[model samples]
Target: MANSFSGADMSLRTDKAVQRGPALQFTVDDQLVDAFSGESVAAALFAVGRRELRQSPRDSAPRGMFCMMGSCQECLVWVGQRQVPACQVPVAAGLAVQTLSFRRQHLD
Candidate 1:
């Protein structure tokens, strides 16, 4: 089978050409991750290799960011009591994020 995704490195690049805001820290699934200002939660997670954002509700299959836009809804995560798309929310210091599967596994 041919490689479905053939392209340059799409992961977050930290070259000097790219300007970023001050460094900040946030928690994903209770694990602290480093992020830069003005970065979306999905970007931050992807940078650190936390790609699996949530599991499929019907089959429990792994899911990650697809469109990187809010319309896809593949990167949904929990922030406090509210469940929001990771691609839509900007990373804030001390912010707590949890995967749906994380909560489900712990709560069960």
Candidate 2:
């Protein structure tokens, strides 16, 4: 599949051409979504309009990408019970991602 960028180009793009690779399939919140190769989990989620990646451990407040460099823990998620920061995880085909909020909701 040919890769295409949607919307205006950013000025900071490198001189090296961006390569669009095949779309990868991953499951988020039990729904299948397509993400491009080399894309981060956070990017995949946001592309699909999934702003709430997890909830606060204290009071269940929704959380998402912030300080995407991994300094902030807002984008926490589970990949087969292993907690990971979404912004730091690369998209993989057939990956099963469960937001902390979903786990709490169904486990109770």
Candidate 3:
């Protein structure tokens, strides 16, 4: 089998680029969050101590980033009009993300 480097060199606060300068700003579920360059959305959220990214669609069980790679499908989140895996999306200034909790709140 071939090798996959999907998340081989990523960490919440270890990326050199991230440590070199100012962090970018973004919103998670309408709450402000900070993200550094070279950090994925998952890493950014995790940096701020956010573990549960979303919940199961069927049972509402808390879900988070299990496979920093893109195989687990556990980090699903909403960005604008589209649903995306948080682990696969890189962080950028002004980016907006909404987790499953947002949907749950509205359902109540």
Candidate 4:
């Protein structure tokens, strides 16, 4: 992928860019969290000291976003029943997240 500012100032198109407001909060396991506009799920989690979001079903090893480019499936998290790629998912408001590979009977 190219740099975020590669052609930001040179683009000739008239289309306006989306203006993201202040950090939005999302509830994860009853905990309210903040995520920046250009941040990914894994990045946001790490920023707030959340390391383990899910684990491998067979081994139950910790897993989350790795490589941070959607090339790895380690960052898979449920977004309202649908499995969404966390590394590739942009931070959004009111995002309902669930973990399918969570360790233990229920994650605390």
Candidate 5:
């Protein structure tokens, strides 16, 4: 069952006016996929079967979407900044995404 937010259940996003028309199309890690224009960067990633978009160098733990509301650090990333939540970010055309593995973060 979907998690309930507030007293009411989490209704489908289709009711939102922003959900009109087809969602913006794009590729994540070179894989073509579709995501709602209202969806954040992380949502687009998950739709493409990418659960671990990055890893912590210290512990090397897999990191991706944790708090769908951008509360946890698990979904943290760098879009030019450290620890940016993927779920809270919106998908945009020409978004150049680079995976930051433990090795990649420290190499540079």
Candidate 6:
């Protein structure tokens, strides 16, 4: 899979250049992922090829960012104790994110 983020820009369009903030580091499922400031958690994860953010509560099917605008709850993940949409949350330095896959693995 191609990286969704490049240099300081997170836009997939190569023709249009986007200015982004400083770089930051965050953890997803205990794996470190690099992200630029102003990037959403989902964006960072997609950049690193982490497509599945959670499994369906009922079926255990894989789920990832769909709408990316928070309209769909497909990208929900745990940040600390709260579950929030990954596409809606901004990447922060040292932020630890836990996907539902991790939880399921631990429970099993």
**Candidate maximizing TM-score:** 1
Q: Which ten residues in a row are the worst by lDDT in model 4?
A: 1-10
Residue by residue across 3-97, what tens digits does model 2's lDDT show? 23222222222338768567777777677766778888888777666678876768978889988778798898888878899999888988988
Please write out the lDDT profile of model 5 over residues 1-108, one tens digit for every residue: 221121122133335555343456554444444555666777666654567877776887777777799788677655544546666667675553445653265546
Q: Could you tell me how far off, in angstroms, the CA of residue 2 lies in candidate 5 after the best superposition?
A: 33
User: Whose TM-score is higher: candidate 1's or candidate 6's?
Assistant: 1
TM-score of 5: 0.60
Q: Report lDDT per candidate.
A: 0.80, 0.74, 0.75, 0.64, 0.57, 0.79
Clashing pairs in 6: none
Instruction: Give the residue spans of candidate 6 off by over 4 A.
Output: 1-16
For every candidate, C-alpha RMSD to the true structure in Å: 7.5, 5.7, 9.6, 10.4, 8.8, 4.5
List TM-score per model, in order.
0.84, 0.76, 0.75, 0.68, 0.60, 0.79
Candidate 1 lDDT for residue 10: 29
Q: Is candidate 1 or candidate 3 better by TM-score?
A: 1
Which ranges of candidate 2 are over 4 A from the true structure?
Answer: 1-17
| Global local distance difference test of model 4 | 0.64
Decoy 6 TM-score against native: 0.79
Candidate 3 RMSD to the real structure: 9.6
Which candidate would rank higher by lDDT, 2 or 5?
2
Write model 4 residue lDDT over 1-108, tens digit each, in one string. Answer: 222211233232223774645667665554556665776777767666666778777897887767888787877777765677777777777775666644234653
Specify the highest-lDDT model's number.
1
